[model samples]
Target: MYLYDHYDQAMVDARVAEFRDQTRRRIEGTLSEEKFRPLRLQNGLYLQLHAYMLRVAVPYGTLSGAQMKMLGDIADKYDRGYGHFTTRQNIQYNWIKLEDTPDILADLASVEMHAIQTSGNCIRNISADQYAGATADELIDPRPYAELLRQWSSFHPEFLALPRKFKICVIASDTDRAAMRLHDIGIQIVKNEAGEIGAAFYVGGGMGRTPFIAPLVKAFVPLDELITYSEACLRVYNRYGRRDNKYKARIKILVHELGVDEYRRQVEEEFAHLQTLAIEPPLAELERIKTFFADPAYEAGLSDDLDLSNPAFAAWVKNNTAAHKTPGYAIVNISLKPVKTLADGSKQAGIPGDATGEQIRVMADLAKTYSFDELRVTHTQNIVLPHVRKADLFTVWEKLVAAELAEANLDKITDIIACPGLDYCTLANARSIPVAQKIAERMADKAEEIGELKLKISGCINACGHHHAGHIGILGVDRKGLENYQLLLGGCEGADTSLGKIVGPGFDEDGIVGAVEKATQVYLANKEGEERFLDTYRRIGMNPFKEAIYG
Candidate 1:
């Protein structure tokens, strides 16, 4: 993890002081809500349906154990005793007091975290692969570049008030775990045929009322021009992007209105102009950032074997762990989604991505004890102990099991990615959490059979839950003044990114859950050997699943 320098500390400290005064003024009635709206939003405070919500940034989803512990402390001290981890690789507290926000910011500042850019129509938190440095498949660790972009975009005067909020993702792997193509700006660091490293720019990807998989704007941009090219893309969007309508203000909308070729041409022209400005950070600075991400010390000649004698531990190891780039080590994922059976024998779903303060503290302790004192928040609303020794797998699993955090359902139907829908978000049309819970319970028994299914839910079209990218996506809508859920299929967020298509007419809450189960049953019955739910859906198409569900 990168430690904050003096300049970084100074800026955060200054923002805290500034916001303290702003918040005081709002509370004292010296500042009107209309006036304080943007100011509070700039600092990541939102007035939700019931109470104020505070979103704290976890840059690229990386946090030190101490930071994670502080997050737990914040949850305990300020709001309710739980925090909601979001799809943007950030965390949110649903019940925040207006007067206590400054103190919360101060607490976060001490840990080198803040709420800045977590909201508003500005560049939001930069996201990346959760297993960036430790994963076996990446070409290079992309966090350094992500950090550089973070520093560059933080309060950049030019982008502070864009036509709409912009999101950027950096991934070095070809597997696309970060949903690279579904961002406003997706930069994939790649090696060319000449064996030189560069970036492939995919601009104009987003999901909302309108969903778009950004087209490849530039196939290869030299490493030296990464920041400049990114700025060029933003400049183009800012210059011509629509300001009249909030609905069509995102860069994705601009790219849709203008063809990819023209957008690329404009970006190229801007890139040429930015080259003279020398806006890209110097190579020395990137090298300095890279130093923070170097591999942890590993004992040489360690064995890469796990004892699978215990059936429970074997299941956890099989589902929640991934191969590490270093031998004898593994990437461990802690599932936040825990399913509980009520005394009535009905299933009760633990709220997805909502980790209680005690659970967060437990995870922090585990990270410190096992994973080099580091933890990562995945885009799927899970946490990752990026580098855990294989020898300690069982102990870690045991600890997680004791904490009730070991769910052994990674990518399974039960491992759902859903937003805090009508429950917390005022913009939501229907309840998303209940729908997610129902689906999880309905499919829990068959989740192992329906393997590698990415199910996502959003209360509205904002796509905060990333429903557009799920293998089976669910969207809640307001239909005839009632909460209706729509089922979508064939969505995938990996390397072959594709938006889900709605199967047919919307259904009521129970109907939607049954519809999802029917779709899965179709997959199980028709699937070839070893085929995932997504593979089966693609091979068999929507007709079979649609007939089963609607008929």
Candidate 2:
């Protein structure tokens, strides 16, 4: 975990004090809602349908066990007993009292965390692969660069308010776990023919009403000039990005209207000019950040072995773990989806990324004991213990099982990414959580049978749940004053990223789950070998799924 120095601490403390005064004025009726809107949003506070929701940033999706415990304490002490982890690798407290907002932020600051930059039109939290330092497939650990971006973008005077929100992501692994291509700026660490490290820039990739898989703007940028290049890109967007309409303001839209060649040309022009200036951070600062992300020390003679006798444990291991760079270690994912349905026959998919206070607390303990006191949040709305020794697999599984945090579905249909739709968000037209719950309940018996499906649900067109990137994307709609859902097929957010295509007409609440079941049947019948839903869809095209749903 990256520890905050005095400078970082002072900056955060000052922001908290400033926001506390703003919160007081708002509560005292001196600051009107119109006046307080931007102020509150800048500090990661939002007035939802019923209450204020606070979003807290988890930089690079990384956290210490102590921070996780504080999060659990925050959830239990002030708001609900659980919190929802978002696709951006942040956490949301949906039931916040406006008066308690300042205190909650203070508590977060005490843990070296804050909600700053979680919202606002400025560059948001920089995210990366959860398996950053531990993954065997990575070319380099991306956390160093991501942390640099975090420091640079935080309260930068040049980009306090841009056309719309800007998101930047970095991925060192060839496999894109952080939705690298779906962000405003995506950094792919690469090596040149000379065996020197650099980055390939993917600019203007985003999903909203308009979706684009970012085009390559730069073939390669030297590692030392990463910040300078990013500044050049953001400068281009700030100057030329549309501001007349909110919907048309993103850099993605700008790139779409102006071809990739033109966009690249402008960015190159800016980069050339930026190179002359002394804007890039000192090399020593970046090296200092890298020290925080060094690989955890492992026992020298640990056995690279696993006792896989129990089928249950084996099943959990197979689904919830990934290969590690170290021979004796594994990357463990703690599934937030409830392992079983409630007494009311509803699966824990109501809010797919939610974790109870107790679960959070215990998971923190597990991290401290088994994972070098470090954990990370995945873009798929799950938590990752990135360096668990292979010898501790059974023990970790047992603890998770006892805490009811063990759900043996990672990329399967049950691991749904859902946004707080009509239930909590004022922007939503239909309910997202209930739809996720229904889909999970419908597919509980058939999860393993379906296998390796990315199911995402969004309340509205904002695509907060990233429904645009799911194998089966569910978008809630308001049709004739009634809640309905429109399904999409063949979308993926991996290394080969593509937006999903809409199937057909919308379906009512009662009909949507059945429609999903029909689509699954079509997939099962046509799938060859061990094909996933996305794999099978690619082979057969969209007509089969459209017909399965419509006819």
Candidate 3:
């Protein structure tokens, strides 16, 4: 949680004043809808299907308990009772009035949060691993780097209007929980053989109409040159990336047109020129940023006593928990997967289509109480109580179960990631959420057997849900308004990341879940005892799943 200094505070306050004037002009008929489009977009406001949607940035997905309370207050006072957490770890309020946006921004500014760079062709939010500081396996926390990038890229004149939206991800651990390989620029922080820290750069990776795993650009970019090298890569893309055709404007398209080798060469040439000016941040500045994230004081010798016999607590610990760097604590994921349905029922789960005000309040209170007065909306559509004490695991689980938020399946097959498709998004060509729900429902009976399968769905080729990185990928497309889904197998989201390969022809909405069921059955039939679905898929390739799914 980086706090805003006077400089940062002044910038936000000035932006709010500017947007206030802009809104007044628009309302006064001086600025038309077309004229206000870019202005509003720059502030993360969008005119959606029914109402205006305002996306607030949760920088690197970090927030304090007080900040969470502020967000809850915003939800209650400004829009509807609940907020929709997006795949990028940002939160969206769908029913905002146009006039109230500036006020909302002011409210967010009070908590050192804002809506800047959340949309538009400029660099979007710099995301990192959600479990950055807490994870036991991380070489270093990636948030500080993410924060550095945020400061550098925010309103940077050179990159304010790139060819298309630019996204960057930083991962510090061996595991790619942040989906580092699926961004415009992905940096894996690694310690070299001599034990010096540096970044491994990957470029031209994205998931949209053209999905690609970023090719390696530099094996080891020194820590001092990260910003310089990144600027060089962006410069190359900005100069040569497609601008005439919006369809091919992304850096991925440029890389596809000019093979990876040539793209690497171009970036190298640019990097060589900028390397001379590269300088590391001052030690004092680095220490100042690090201070914001200093480890919270914990009682010493906390790991020595433990009771593992509580079955409910043990199940939650085993499934939704990850090892923390601290001995006495664990990072807890508050599962949003409703146990009422399997894959296909996600759309119908949680607050139903006809949910009332009371239900939304209950959901909000559940977050406020059990989750350290703070909750992180994960990229996987689940909420995380990232700092839950190990001792309180049972109490949290009990509360979550009462609210239908406890599914006991954190990485299992039923915990599908899906986007709002034709149902909500005007850009979608096919429905995605319903299809994901149906798949979840189909696999409900064999939920435990499927074991840690990631089924990701994208409504269209835009790949917003990152279907390409799923262990099992489902892409929905439209054929004359009829929903058709294409299944891809063997994708992974961990350290050994790989893009999924498409199976056979696409299946109709009715047939897609059956196809998924068949694929899972194939996995069950072929898997050795206790072997996860991903391990089985990797060991035996896609043939078995393909045969079963298609046949």
Candidate 4:
């Protein structure tokens, strides 16, 4: 985790003071709501359906145990008893008081965290692979580059008021855990034939009503020109991105309107101009940032072994853990979507990504005791103890089981990622959480049978839940003033990124759940040995699933 220096501390403190005054003025009726809108949005405050929602940034999805604890404390003291971890790897408090927001900001500042850029039409939180440093597959830890971009994008005067909200993702691995291609700017740190490291840029990828998998804009950009090239990309978007209509303001829209070749040409022209200005951060600064991310001290000669005798623990280890770069260490993913049995003897799904304050505190404690005192929030709305030792797997499992956090469903159907739909977001057309819960409940018994299915839901076309990337996606919409659900299939967010396509006619809430189950049955019946739902869908295509669901 990157510790804030005096300058960073001063900037956050100053923002808190400024926002406090802004909030006070709004409460006292001195500042009109129209005037307060941008000010509050710049600080990551949104007036939601019922109350204000505060989004706090977890940059690059990395957090120290102390920071995690503070987030829990804020949930307990300021808002309700829980917080929703978002697809952006940030956390949101739904019910916030206008006056108490400053105090909350101050609390966050104390832990070197803030709400800046978590909202607004600016470069939002820079995201990366959750298992960045610890994972065995990455070419390099992508967080450093992500952090570099973060510092560059934060309050950059040029992009503060882009036509629409922009997002950027950095990844070093060929496997795209962070949905790299589905961002406004996706940078994959790469090594060329010369063994020199650089970046490959993918531009104009996004999902809203109009979903697109960004085209590769540049094959290789040298490390020295990384920031320069990034600025060029943003400059091109800012210069020509749509502003007349909010609906078409995303960079993706611009790229669509202006072909990828022209977009690349403009970016290249801007890059040539930026090169002379020397805007790229000095090599020393990046080196300084790299120092903060050096691997934690580890005991040598640790055995790379786990005794998975207990069936329950063994299941958890197999499902919840990923191979680590270091011997005897594993990347442990904590699933927040555990199923709950109600008093009526029916199972209900725990809201995906919702964690109570106590649960957050427990996760922090687990990180402190078992991992390396560090936790990561995944873009999938889960948490990761990125460097847990294999020897302590049982104890970690025991504690998580005690806390009811040990759900061995990673990439499984039950591990769904969904957004707060009509429940919290005013822009939503229909409720998403209930639909997600229903689907989870319907599929819980067959989760193992279904296998490695990624399901996502969104209340609207904003794609905040990343429904566009799911193997099976559920989108809630309004039809004839009634809530309706649309099912999408064959989408993926991995290295081979693709947007899901709607299968057939929309269904009511119950109908949608049944339709999803039917689709799964189609998969189980037609799937070859060890084929994932996605594989079978691609092999068999949408017609079989469509016929099964709609008929």
Candidate 5:
């Protein structure tokens, strides 16, 4: 993790003081709600359904054990003794008090974390693969660039009031774990034909009332010009993106209206001018940032083997661990899904990306003991100890089992991605969590048989759960004073990213779960040998599933 320099420290300290005053003014009625709204939003505070919610940033999903422990501490001290880890790789305290926010921000600053850019119509938290540095498939560690972008974009005067809330995601590997294509600006670090490292920029990717997989605006941007090119893209969007309608304000809407080619031309024109303005960060600063993300030392003679004698341990390893770049190490993913049981004496669903305070501390200690004191937050709302030695895999699993964090359902049907729908979100028209729980319970038994299904649920059309990118997408819609969920099929957020198409009519709570199970059953029955759920959907098309659900 990049430790804050003097400048970083000074800025954070200064901001905390500024916000403390702003908060005091709001509470004292010196500042109106209309005026204080943006001020509070920029600082990552939102007045939700029952109380204020505070979202704290986790840059590129990277956090040290100390930072993780601080989050646990914050949850314990200020909120409701738990935090919601979000798809954007941040943490949200749903039960925040207005007066306690400043103190919370201060505590976060002390740990080099903040709520800055976690919300508002500005560049939001920069997300990337949780396994960025440790993944075997990565070409280079991307956190340095993510950190550089983080520093540059934070409070940048140019983008402080963009057309809408903009998001940027980065990925170094070919696998699109961060949903790079579905961001306002998605940058993939790539090696060109000449073997020079550069970025492939994807613009206009987003999901809301309108969903778009960002097209490749520019094939390649040189390493030195990453900042300049990014500024160019932002400058174009900031200037041309529609402000008349909030729904169409995202860059994706702009790209859609203007077409990708015209958008590319505009970005290029801006890039040409921005380059001359010396928008690139100093090379020394980048190099200095890189040093902070270098791989930790691995011990010799560490064996790349796990004792699978325990069937339970074997199940967890099969689902939660990934191959590591290092010879004797493994990447371990922790499931934060709180278990639910059905009324019929069967298992139910789970919360997609939530961890209790105790679980946070346990994970922090696990990272310290097994993963070089570093941990990562996955986009799917799980935790990753990206460099656990394979020899200690069972030990880690045992600890996780004790904490109830080892669920053995990474990409399975039970591993759902759900937004805090009507339960916590004021924008939501329907309930998402209960629906997610129901669906998970319905599909829990056939997890492996179904295989690699990315099920996502969103409370409303904001697509916070990334329902647009799920293999089985569930969108909660308000129907005549009742909650109804509409199902979708064939969505993917990967190297081959595509948005899902809605399937027929919306279903009531129980009906929706049954619909999802029927959709999966359709896949399981028709799928060829070893075909994943998405694979089957892609192969056979939506007709089969649609027929099953609607008929």
Candidate 6:
């Protein structure tokens, strides 16, 4: 995690003071709702369906235990006693009072956090893999680059009023856990044959009314020119991206209208122009940011006495754990899947309820006690304690079970990813959570037969849940006020990623789980015993799954 420099600290302090005054005016009626909308949105405050929602940035999805505690405190004192972890790897409080927002920002500032650039048509939070620095396969830590972009884009005068909201993702690993290809700007960190590290840039990728897998703009952008080149890309979009219609305002629309080749040519021309006035950050400054992300002090010795035989611990290890960069530690995913009965009983059908305050507190404590006091909210709607020592795995699993947070399904079939659909989001066309929950429960019932799979659901084409990247994707839609879902399959999130294709006609929300189950059964029947769902799907292609799903 990068600490704020004096410049960063000063800017945040000043912004807090400015927002405090803005708050006072809004409450005093000196500023009308119409007038205050943009001001409040710039600070990450939104007037939602029922109340104001305050989204706080968890930069690159990294948080210290103390920071997590502060978030828990904010949830306890300011709003309801729980926060919603979002797909963008941020946290949201849905019941904030308008007057309390500035105070909340001040509180967040105390912990080196804030709500800046979280909303409105500006560069939003820069997301990276939750397992960034700790992942065993990373080419390099991507956080320093993410942090640099954060500083450069935050309140960048030219970009604050872009044609539409823009998102950027940077991934250092060959495996695309961050869904880099789906971002407005996806940068893959890679080393050239000459052994110099640079970025492979992908542009115009997004998932809204229109979905696209961004095409590559540069095979290798020099490390020193990342900022300049990014600025050039945004500047081109800001200048030419559609603004006449909200539906076509995104850069993706621009890319679609102009065609990818033309879009690339435009960006290249812009890049060439930016080179004349390039304002590269000093190499020393880049190195300084990198220092903050240097590997944590890790013990070198291995403990052979560790036991992994307990059934519950074994299940958790087998399902929710991943290899760490260090030999003696593991990345642990805390499942958000409710018990089958509770999941079925929830009002919205498939979505689980927010983590209770007690659950949040337990997780915070566990992070402090067992995982170096660090926690990451994953894109899969689960929390990750990324650096748990191998020795503490069983103890952590036991504590998680007591809190009902341990379902022992990390990348398994029941570990579904879904967004807060109709339950909370006004933009949702149908309820997504319920659909995801039902599918998870269905898979759980056939846990032995289903084996490993990924099912992702999103309420609409916005693809907040990343439905496009799932091996099994479910997208919710509205048909004459009736909830319906479309099923897609064969998408992947790893090295050789591709978007899923729709299986056939859509299903009513109630029929979605059965449809998914049918598809899974086809995979099970057709697969070689040891093959994963994705491997099986690729080997057999989508026809088998589609025929089975729609049969």
RMSD vs true structure, all candidates: 1.0, 1.4, 3.2, 1.1, 1.3, 2.4
Q: List the residue pairs that clash in candidate 1.
A: none
What are the lDDT scores of the predictions, listed in order? 0.92, 0.90, 0.78, 0.92, 0.90, 0.83
TM per candidate: 0.99, 0.98, 0.92, 0.98, 0.98, 0.94
Summed backbone clashes in each candidate are: 0, 0, 13, 0, 1, 4
As a TM-score, model 1 comes out at 0.99
- lDDT (tens digit, per residue) of candidate 4 on 1-551: 78889988998899899999999899899999999998888789999999999999999999999999999999999888999999999999999998999999999999999999899989999999998999889999888898889889988999998999999999999999999999999999999999999999999999888999999999899888889999999999999999999999999999989999999999999999999998999878888888889998866778988898899899899889999988988899999999876799789789999999999999999999888799999988999999888898899999999988998889999999998999999999999999889888988878987889999999998888899999999898989999998999989999989889999899999999999999999999999999999999999999999888877
Q: What is the lDDT of residue 116 in candidate 6?
A: 92
Which of the two candidates, 1 or 3, achieves a greater TM-score against the reference?
Answer: 1
| Cα error of candidate 5 at position 261, Å | 1.2
Off by over 4 Å in 1: 342-345
lDDT of 5 by residue, 509-544 (tens): 999999998998898789898888898889999898
Error of 1 at 70 (Å): 0.3
Per-residue lDDT for 466 in model 6?
80
Model 6 alpha-carbon miss at residue 200, Å: 1.4
- Model 6 ranges off by over 4 Å: 340-353
> Candidate 3, residues 102-164: lDDT per residue as tens digits?
999999989888899898888898888888877888899887878878887888788877899
Model 4 — which ten-residue stretch has the worst lDDT? 297-306
lDDT of 6 by residue, 377-489 (tens): 87677789988889888889889989888887677667777877887777888887777766766567566456778778889888887888888988998889888899988
- Please state the error at residue 307 of candidate 1 in Å: 1.5
Clashing pairs in 4: none
CA lDDT of 186 in candidate 2?
93
